[model samples]
Target: MLKMMTYFQGFSGHQSVPVTVDFPRSPPKLPSTSEAESETSMSEASSEDLVPPLEAGAALYREEEKAAKKKEKKKSKGLASVFSVFTKGKKKKGQPSSAEPEGAAGSRQGLDGPLPTVEELKAALERGRLEAARPLLALERELAAAAAGGASAEELVRRQSKVEALYELLRDQVLGVLRRPLEAAPERLRQALAVVAEQEREDRQAAAAAGPGTSALATTRPRRWLQLWRCGVAEAAEERMGGRPAEGAEVPESVFLHMGRTMKEDLEAVVERLKPLFPAEFGVVAAYAESYHQHFAAHVAATAQFELCERDTYMLLVWVQNLYPNDILNSPKLAGELQGVGLGSLLPPKQIRLLEATFLSNEAANVKELMTRALELEAQRWAQDMPPQRLDGHCHSELAIDIIQIISQAQVKAESITLDLGSQIRQVLLVELLAFLRSYQHDFNEFLERGKKLRSYRANVIANINNCLSFRTSMEQNWQVPQDTLSLLLGPLAELKSHGFSTLLQSLCEDLKPLFKRFSHTRWAVPMETLEKIIATVGVRLPEFSELQDCFREELVEAVHLHLVKEYIIQLSKRRLVLKTAEQQQQLAGHILANADAIQHFCTEHGSHATWLQPALPTLAEIIRLQDPSAIKIEVATYATSYPDFSKGHLSAILAIKGNLSNSDVKSIRSILDVSTGVQEPSRPLFSLIKVG
Candidate 1:
C-alpha cells in the first residue's frame, strides 16, 4: 500500500513510504507516529494493499503535498515582502513621508511648493534649493501615472512643477559637484568639470556685461575671473597634493585656459595681476598674449622655451621699447629681446628692414657706446655658451660708419685735436670710405667703359669726396692737420682724378676709337667730325682752370704762343729729314710738294724768312767764301749765295748736310733760295739732304 501510495504521490519507488497520511481541514492537525514505527510499518505493507491504499493515500497525500508546497512557496515570497517592509520601516524612522495629496506633493516639498508658477520655479532655482523639492516631484510623478489618458489642469501644474523641480535639482547637483571642495573630489573629473563650470559662469558674466554700457565691466570681470580661476586651480592643486605643482610640472589645462581667457578679455588686468604673483608665469602669459594678438603663437612656440620669469623679461623689453623708441633704433639688445620672444621670425621682411633701420638709427649716437655694449653682450653670451642674436652684416657696416662719424664730429669740434685721435679717426674714415668706393667702383668703371649713366655712382663718390675735403679744410683751418689727414685728403684726390681720366681715356681708345675709324673711312671728313665730338665730350673746360685764369698776364700768353710755334716748326723740320726708306722719303717729299705753296704762303705771312735770315747771315757769308764744286761744297756755295755776310760755320750747321749729300742735292736746295736778298723762299726747300744723312 505504501508503494502504491508512493507511486500515486509521485515519489521514487526506492524510498520507504509512511502508513498514515494527513489532509488539511478547517483547522490544522498533527500525525501521530513514532519514528521507528513509521519506518517498520512502511516496510510491512504488501504490494497490493500498498498499491491500492497507496493509490488512495497517494491521491490525498499528493493533494496535501501540493498544498504544502504552495504554502512553502508563499512563505518564501513573504520573506521578501517582510525584508522590504523592514527596510522601509527603518528608512522611514529617520525621514517620514509627508501626508500631502498626490497632486500637491511636488509643491508641498518646499522647492516646487505652491509657489504658483514658472516664475516661482525660476526663483526657486535661483535660490539654489531645487534639491529640497523631492516630495513635490514625487507628487507630480504620481499624478502623471494616474492620469495616463490625459492630465487635468491641476495635474498639468503638478507635472510642470515636478519637471521644473527636477530640472533645478539636476542643475543644483551639477553645480554642487563642481563646487565641491576640490580636494574632496576625484582629481581628473573634478578639474575638468570645474573648468567647464567656471567657463560657463564666465561666459554668462561676459554676456551680461557685453552690451555697450557694460563693456568695461565685462572686460574687467573676465580678467579678474581668470585670475580667480588660476588662483583657485593653484590653491586646489596645492591643497590636493600638499604643495604647489612640482617645478616644471605641466600647468593644468584648466589653468592655461583660465589664463588665456583672462588675457584675451582683460590683458591689462591680467598683466597687473600676474605682475606681482608669478613674474615668470606672468611673462609667459604676457608673451603668449602678445603672440596671440600678433598672430604669432606658432613662431613663439617654435623658438622659445617656457620659463618662470619670462613674462617679466618680456614686459621689461616692451617697456624699454616704449620708454626709449630711439634705443630700439640704436641698441641691438632691444631687437634681440624681441627676437628671443619669437618676434624676429614672425616679423615681415619689410618690418624686419624697418627694425634694422631702427637699430642703425639708435646706434648713430656715441657709436663707441653701442659697439662696446654689443661686444660685451657678445662676450657674455659666448662665455655662457648662448646662441647669438639676430645681428646681420648690415649691422656691422652701420656700426662701423657710426663710430667713424662720431670720432670725426668730435675731432671737428676740438680746436686742437691730438694727432693720435686725428690719425685714428682719419684711418677709420678712410677704411669706411674705401669700402664704399670698392662697392661702387665696378659700377663706376662700367659707366666709364660702356658710356652708361653714372649719376648714382657719382653722387656717392661726390659725397665721400666732399666729406674728406671738408675734413681736410677743417683740420687745416684749425692748424692741426695730421700727416695722415693731409695724405688722405691730397693724395687721394690726385689719384682719383688721374685714375678717372685714365679710365675714361682707355675706354675711349677701346670702344670709341673703332667707331671713329669706321666713320672716318666711310664718311667725308668724319675724322675731324669725330674729333670735334671727342673734344666736346672730354676736353677740359678752360674756364674752370681758376688758378690759371687768376694769374693770367698778356706777356705770359704771348711767350707761350711763340714757344709753341717754334717748337712745332723745329719738330716738323726734324721729322722731314728723318724719313728712312725711299718710299717714306718719297711720301714726305710728295706731302711737302703738295703743300709747298700753302707753307710758303704761311711763312711769308708770318715773316719766318726774315727771322731765319737774321740768325744765319754770318753762316751764309762763310759758306759763300767756300766755292768748291767737287771739293768746294755746294751747301757752302748755296749759303754763300743766299747770305753773303753769314759765317761759314753757321751756314754749315744750319744746312745740316755736313757730309753725305752730293753737290746736286745741295745745289737743288740753293735753287729754291732768293739770291738777291740772301734769303731762302719760305715755301722752298728749307733743307736738302740725301736719305742716308
Candidate 2:
C-alpha cells in the first residue's frame, strides 16, 4: 500500500511520470470461512473496480507534459526571431555577423594585416589612425595579462615579444608628436593625446578592477607617456639651440636670438593650436614652457662653463637675463599663455651668479681694453698732427662717446638681468673708467706740452677738455658715482681743464705782454695808442672763441677778463711814477679810465659775465684822479667798498702814486681804509691775483 501510494503521488503531481504499473495477478481468494471474511472480500473488489486503468492515466500525463514543453519551445522561438530582426536592422551595412569564422570576419573588418612594423605604425599615426591602433594596444595588454597569468615559457616570450613591439611603436609615435607638435596634424596631435588619456584611463581601471595580487594589475604598464612628452619637448628645445657656435665663428647674439625665436614660435602654436585640442588637466602650454625652460637652462649652464670670449659671455647674459624673461617667456604673444606655469630660471641661481661674475670680470677687461684703444686712437690722431674734427664749430672726439657707450651698455645689460648685477658692474666699470681717466690725463698733458706749436694743438686741447666734461657728465648720470670716486675721476678732469685753459690763455697773454710792458706813469699821459693796440689784439681772437663749447666759452671769457684786469693793475703798480701836479694826476686818471672802458667793452661783447671785475678798474681810476685830500679819501673808501680784495700792499702802492699828499694826509687816507671788516671775498678775486711786490 505504501509503494502504491508513492507511485500514485508521483504520477498525480505536476511532475511527468510513466503510468505503467504491475498489479497482483488476481485478488487473493482469501478465507471464505466466515460471513465477515466474505463481506471484506466484496469490499476490496469494489475498491479495485473504482480504480482507473494504468495505460489511460499514463498516456494522459504524457500528453499534458509534451504539450507544456512544446508551448514553451514555440514561445522562445518567436522571441528569438523578433530579437534577430531588431539586431540585424541595427547592424551596419556589410558588417559581418558574430557567427562568421574569425578569419573571414577579420578580413572584412580591415583588421587583418601583418603585425604593424614600427614604420607602418608611424605611417598610420601620421595619418591620425589612433582609433584604428587601439585594438592593437588592447591586444598587447591582453598578451601582458596572459603572460602574467602563468603562461608557458615559450608562450610568454611570444606574447611579450608582440607586446614589446607594440610598446616601442607607441612610444615612438607619442614622442615624435611632442617633439614636432607644430609639424604634426592638429587632429593627429589630438588623437595622440586622446590615446594617452585612454591609456591612463585603462591603467586606472585595471588597477581598480584587479585585486592586489591579481595578474591584471601586475601586467599593467604605468602609461608614462605624459612624462615622455616632457622629455620630448626638452629634446625639441635642445635641437632648437642650433648647437654651439662653429669653431671660428663668433658666438654672436643670433645664437640666443634663434633659440628664443623658435621657442616662442613653437610655444605659441601649442597655446593657440594644441591647447584647445587637449583637456585642461593636460596643461599643454605649461608643459611645453617648463620643458623648454629646463632644457634651455641646462644648455646655458653647459655653455657658460666653457671658456667663452667677452662677446660670447655678453650675448649669453643678454639672452638669459633679459630676452628670455622679458621678451620671450613673458612676451605679449604669450602673456596669458603661461599664467600658471612656474618657469624656473634659465640657469640655476648658483649658475647665474657665476655667469654674472664672469660677465662683470669680462666686462671690466673689455672696458679697459676698449678705453685704452680709444685713447690710443686719439693719440694716433694727435701723432698724425690731425686736429680733432669739429662738430658745429666745436672740437669733438670719439673718446667720451665710445667710453660712455661701453659702460652704459654693460650696465644696461647687467641691470636688465638684475639690479645687484648692475651695481656690481657699475663698480667694475668705475674702476676701469678711473684708470682710463688717469691715462687720458697723462696722454693729454704730454700732447699739450709737446704739441704746443702744432696747428691742431688748440683744437685737440679743447676736444680733450670736452671729453673730460663728457666723461664726468655721463658717469654722474649713468653710474652711482660715490663722492670719493667722483673726486678721483674729477681730479684728472679738473687738472686737464686747468692745463688746457692755461695753454689757451698763454697765447693771448703772449700777445698782450708787450702791450702791457709799455704802460708806465710817464706813458700813461700819452695818446691811448697802446690801449687801442691792446683792444685790437683782443678783437682778433674774439671770433675764435666761438669755437669753444658754450659753458667753457663763458668761463674762458671770464678768465680772460680777470687776467687782463690783473695785468693792468700789475703794470700800473710797477711804475712808482708820482702824480705830483693836478694835471699829471688828472691825465693819468683819464688814461686809466679810457683803458678800463676798452677792457670792459671788449669782455662784455664777447660773452664775459664778470660784471664784478668791471668795477675794479673804474673805481681805481676814480681814486687816482681825485686830488683834494678829503675827496681822495672818499674815493679810496669807494675803491675799498667795490674791490674788497684790495689789500694794504695795494693801498700803499696807490698812496705812493699820490705824490702831492703830505705824509699826514696819506696817513689819514690810509687810516680811513679799514681791513678789519669781515667782508666776503670776491668769487673771482683780481687784486688777490695781483702781487704788489
Candidate 3:
C-alpha cells in the first residue's frame, strides 16, 4: 500500500473529536494501474483472523472466569478483613472495632503502615485484587474533601503527593492495557475495568457524604482516567492502519484494503475477547467500531488527496461503500453486532459521488481515445489501399469488433465493481460512442462518394455498412443503455447503413439507366424488351448483396425493391403518352402490369422481406387498366388508403397514364383519394419517393 501524511492522531478518550477529511478537488488522471501483491498476503491472513477458534475463545473465557473467582476469594479472605469495615459496616461510637481483634493498642496502626508502592498496587491490580487498590482511591478522595473543607493547601499537597503519584501510575497502566487489547492479557483488561468501576462508586459515595455546597471535589476530580480511556481506543484503531505504507513506496495494493482487513480482524477480537471485560454502559464493541470507522474514513480521505490509479480508486470505493458494511461490519460472525448503532459512510456522500463521477469521466475519456485510435488505424489501412478482409465470402472490418470489445469490457469491469455503477459507466461510453459513430458515418460516406476509383472501394463500403448494422444490433440488445441514448446512437448508424445501401443500389441503378431510358409510352405502343433488360441488370447485382448480414441483406433487398418500383413509376409518369381510346389504355395498362410482375418477382427471388411493397406498383397499374369511371375512382381511393404517402401528384400521374381519362374525370377521381381517411401509414413507404407532374 502507498502511504501518505499521518492523520487521525491525538484523539481524546474523554471527549469526541471530529475527524477532518479533505478530498482531492480533481480526479486522478487515467492510467493502467496494477494491484499490489501485499493485498493477497493480507487477505490470506484475514481469512484466519476473522473467526478465532471456538476452543481458544471458550478457553480464554474459562480462564477469565477462574481468575475472577480467585480475585473474589482473595478479597474476601485477605483484603476484606483489613478494609471491610471501611467499606461495609458502620463504625462503632467511641469504641475500637472488634474486627481489629484483642491486641496491644500499639499494633492498631496496621492501616497506617507505609502507603503501598506503585509496584505493589500494579501487582495487586494484575492479580485482580482490585480491593487492594481501594485504600489509595479512598485517600485521594479524602484529600479532595479536606481541601474543599478549607484545609490548608500545603497540608493537602503534602498528604496527597505520594498517593496521587501511585494512583496516576495505576491509571496509566489501565489505559495502556486498553490501548492494545490484542497484545494485553484478558485479566489485565478485567482488572482495569474493575478499577474504573470502583472509583466511580467511591466518588459517588464521597459526593453523597460531603453533600451539596460542602465538597464539589468528588464530582470535580476531572474523571481524566475515562478521557484517557477513549484516547487509548482511538490510538488502537490508528495503529491497526499499518502505519503510513512505508513512505515513498509505490502503493502495490489499495491502502484501504489493507486497512479494512486489519480493522475487521481487530474489531472481531474486541467483540469476542474484550467486550465482556467492560461494563455494558461503556459500549465496548460500539466504541471500538466507531473508532475504527472514523480512522478508516479519515485515512481514505487522506489517500484520496493523492493521485490514485483507476484500480485503486475502484477498490477504495468498493470497500467504503459496499464491502465494509456487507463483508466486515455486518459479517456473519458479527451479525446483529452493530444494529441501531448510528454508523455512517466511510466517506461522506459528497466524496463518494465525486469518486464515482471521476471514474465515469475517466472511462468515457478512455473510450473516446480508443475509438479515435481505431478510426485512425482504419484510415491508415484505407490510405494504404488494403483490401477488406472477407468473412465467409462477405467483406469484413475489425472496426466494429474492436469498438464493441472496448465498450463491453468497460461495462463488465464496472459491473464487477457495482451494478448501479455499470449503468452510469455505460451511459458515458454511449455518449462517446455516439460521437464516434458520427465520425464513422462521415468517414464511410466520404469513402463511398470519392473512393469509387480505389480497388477496395466497393468492399470497404459494404464492410462499413456491416459495421453500422452490427453497432445498431448491439445497442438494441444492451439493457444498460437508456432508451434515449439508444435512440441517439441508432440515428447515425441508421443513416450510415441507409447511405451504404443506396450507394450499392446506385451502382446497380447506373447499369439500369440505359434500360430505363428505353421505357416510353411510344415504345410501349409496340412489344418491348426493356423490362427484361432492367430485371437482368438488377438480378446480377442481387447476388453481391447476399454478402451482407442476414438482417442487413434483407433490408438492402427491400431498399432495392422500393427503388425499382419508384423508378419504374417515374419512367411511366414522365413518358410521352396519349392513349385516348379504351383499347389503347388497356394495352398500356397491360404493359404496366407486366413490368410490375417482373420487378416484384426479381425482388422476392432475391430475398426481400418487403412484401408490403409488392402491391404498390400492381395497384397503380390496376387503376390505369380500369375503364368504368366509378371503378377507376374506387381503385384510386384504395391505393391512397393503403399508402398514406400516396399524394395528389401520384394520382394525377396515374390518370394521365390511362390517357383515356378526361380532365373532368381525372379531377373527380382525384377527389376520391383526397377524401380517403384513416389510412395506416406503411412502415416502409414507397410512393413517397416518387415525384410526378
**TM-score: which candidate is best?**
3
What tens digits encode model 2's per-residue C-alpha lDDT throughout 318-364? 67776677667676658688766768567777767777788788768
Question: Scored by CA lDDT, what does every candidate get?
Answer: 0.33, 0.65, 0.65
The residue-by-residue lDDT of candidate 3 on 568-625, one tens digit each, is 7777778366567887777777777777787788788877777787777788778877
Error of 1 at 260 (Å): 14
What value does the lDDT take at residue 612 in candidate 3?
Answer: 80
Stretches off by above 4 angstroms in model 2 are 1-192, 202-225, 228-258, 380-427, 452-494, 504-508, 521-523, 527-529, 540-557, 575-591, 622-644, 658-682
Q: Rank by TM-score, highest first.
A: 3, 2, 1
Global CA lDDT of candidate 2, please?
Answer: 0.65
Off by over 4 Å in 1: 1-228, 231-265, 269-299, 303-433, 442-494, 501-541, 544-693
Model 3 regions more than 4 Å off: 1-131, 134-159, 184-188, 204-224, 242-253, 304-327, 330-335, 350-363, 391-393, 408-430, 479-485, 525-530, 676-685
Better of 1 and 2 by lDDT: 2
The local distance difference test score of model 3 is 0.65
